[model samples]
Target: MSTDTQHGESSLLIQLQHGLKREQFERALHDIRAGWNRRELWMTLGLHDVRQRYRRSKLGPFWITLSMAIMVLALGLLYGQIFGQDLHDYLPFLAAGFVIWGLIASLVNDGCQSFILAEGMIRQLNAPLSIYAYRGLWSILIAFAHNIWVFLGVALWFGVDLNWNLLWVPVALLVLLLNGLWMALFLGLVSARFRDVPLIVGSVVQVLFFITPVIWKPEMLPGRALWLDLNPFYHLVEIMRAPLLGQAPALANWLPVIAITVVGWAVALFFYSAYRWRVAYWV
Candidate 1:
């Protein structure tokens, strides 16, 4: 908070700004790039998103969690019976998946539209494109935190045991957030070039939801379990669900998930860097 510290920080950021624009990919890579107080940026952007979301509603951010719970209840009651799954066990599984999926869906849906949605601020202020994407990511995380209330409710309602595996929940969330950030950076940058990119992402999320195992269990797939390996969403859902279910994913499950997220993240950074400068003008 000292003037000296502020000056040093500004100088450092300026250096990054210069290096960032040296090429296309690096510019977008600047946000989550290591050694730049990444935690602080995440926390700051997260708070900004929360404030914006609650600014309109009197109950503010709690509404996000509340809305998420309602959706789960509605879907679980209907889909549990339709799928012939018992609501007692099924509701808890569905609750965990619902909260995590919202984070994924929001990241993709909002990432595809992050910059466009933040246009007024982008144009009026010297906002980093990554910050805009972070807003979307933060909003989802906050909502996920709120929806976690359902985790408790579901367990108690079904008389499920709260296990030590629940401690791994944060690790799973980090994986989800990392993937979400990549989606936001890559899609947000590209979508700016083609206005329809947002619409396309929206449609894909809808189509993929049915294909992915949200309403049902992965065990329902029969011999096609190998096919589930191909879905990034499946791993994402499993990462969160496994922990709460007291069956935390093995290294085999997570090694691949981490690899996939890293590769996708690198690709998105490339696109973001390649297109970051033009984003201001595009919006």
Candidate 2:
């Protein structure tokens, strides 16, 4: 009995010696690095998601473009009437606002749930939290591409010119992509922990729409609307819209978005690094 008891104690000591806190950190690093290497997984998964989204529909991918165009037309006409604006002048403006805001909103709304949406694959594979962030980014890219139809329709209707200023469009999109990743990283972790983020985000976004200059022109408000100067989202939207209107975006617009991005990314990196493990468990 003494020999058997000693053997049991020795076995536990061996196990404890083998299991160190350093090993836990190393394992976590490995998972994060593996995730980085498999970055393509997010792109692939995003494509699969896009395909699955319209798989059963007769129109397939075109459905996304067609649907967005329909929405822009319906909403522009309805809201322009409600606001007592000229349909011709307001339609293009409304189209630009709607499409850009849709991309931003989708990034915020779905980005939070990115990990939750990708849980099945995350479980099967050892990867980095960044992949889920990329998945959310790619999803927004797909939607934004589809939303281009709103611009085409607006241009056709109002002769909205796309000139050299339009070149800024890509730069604006890059800024948007950066913001999307940061939001996905931060919000994704929060949603995993709380499970109520989607609902709260939805309600907040709905209110934010009326507060934003989507249907109404910024000029409609006096000095108070200058408050938009402080909102990074307002600047992000303006940078995208100004070029489409063949004008340089206000220099005032650039700083806020960049500042928000710098601070947001720093916060996001820490949040993702810390909460990444909890995400796996939550999933």
Candidate 3:
């Protein structure tokens, strides 16, 4: 608290700022690497978030599975009748797509709050900012872990083929998680600076749910509309859903997802490198 000590601290802070300016990208990479090294901390925090959200509820996290099962059953039955599709086929497809969609939707929606929700920690802790991104992604993955059971049950009931193609599921999930990380970094940074971003993101996600092939098959569209080809969510979901349903996702599906993942990371890393230092103040 002495004047000399205060002056020295201020000088060090200024020097740190100048260093960050000159090595912004390196600093961003360092943050990510450091965050990974502290996975135990974020993983514990993420698991704590899941448990805390369901505290005192008898069903606890199983509620995720139950709710997803109910939605899939209701939609599968109604849509099967309406579209004249076989219940056997439609239900499994719906279950798989809905489960994958749940992961993607939660990642994007929760990514918006990745930094904002950690405002106190961000301000007080001298930890890597990327930890918040990892924490948010881990929490959503926990939810997805629960939700996947719904699809497994439906697949069992429908006798959906489980073949070698199913191995692709882990790869698809890895790709999705990579996409989720960038989304958390990018969206979290932007959302920290703009309070309205979460609301806008939520609205957009809801709209995308309908437009994406969650409730309907792509072939349901006559000639497979051009827009379906362009819908990134369609490809994202297909990459996961196809494997769960015992089909290897076509190159068509993998191509768009790969392209999106690359472009998204580039954009995310650029903004994250430039503005990561400002997040503590913004949040």
Candidate 3 residue-wise lDDT, 126-213, digit = tens: 9999999999999899999999999999899989998999999999999999999999999998899789999999999999999999
Question: Estimated TM-score per prediction?
Answer: 0.82, 0.85, 0.92
Residue-level lDDT of model 2, residues 1-283, one tens digit each, is: 4344557746534543543346544654565566668767778888888888889889888887888888888988888888888877788888888889998888889888988887887788756767887877886798788788778778777987778998998899899888987888788878876889878998888887778888888877876665666666788888898887778777888888888889998777655555566677777
lDDT of each: 0.77, 0.78, 0.91
| Candidate 3 global TM-score | 0.92
Ranking by TM-score: 3, 2, 1
**On residues 1-283, what C-alpha lDDT tens digit does candidate 1 reach at each position?**
6355557646535543653655545544554454134456656766876777689787788887788778989999999888899888899888888777777888789888878887887888754667777767777777777878987788788987678888888888887888888888789887886899889889988887877788888888777677678887787778778888788567767877889898998787766665667677788
lDDT of 2: 0.78
Off by over 4 Å in 2: 1-37, 224-226
In angstroms, give how far residue 186 of model 3 lies from its true place.
0.2
> Against the true structure, whose TM-score is highest?
3
Show pairs that collide, candidate 1. Answer: 24-273, 24-274, 25-273, 25-274
RMSD of 2: 7.1
- Give candidate 1's error at residue 185 in angstroms: 1.1
> Which pairs clash in model 2?
35-128
Stretches of candidate 3 exceeding 4 Å from the true structure: 1-22
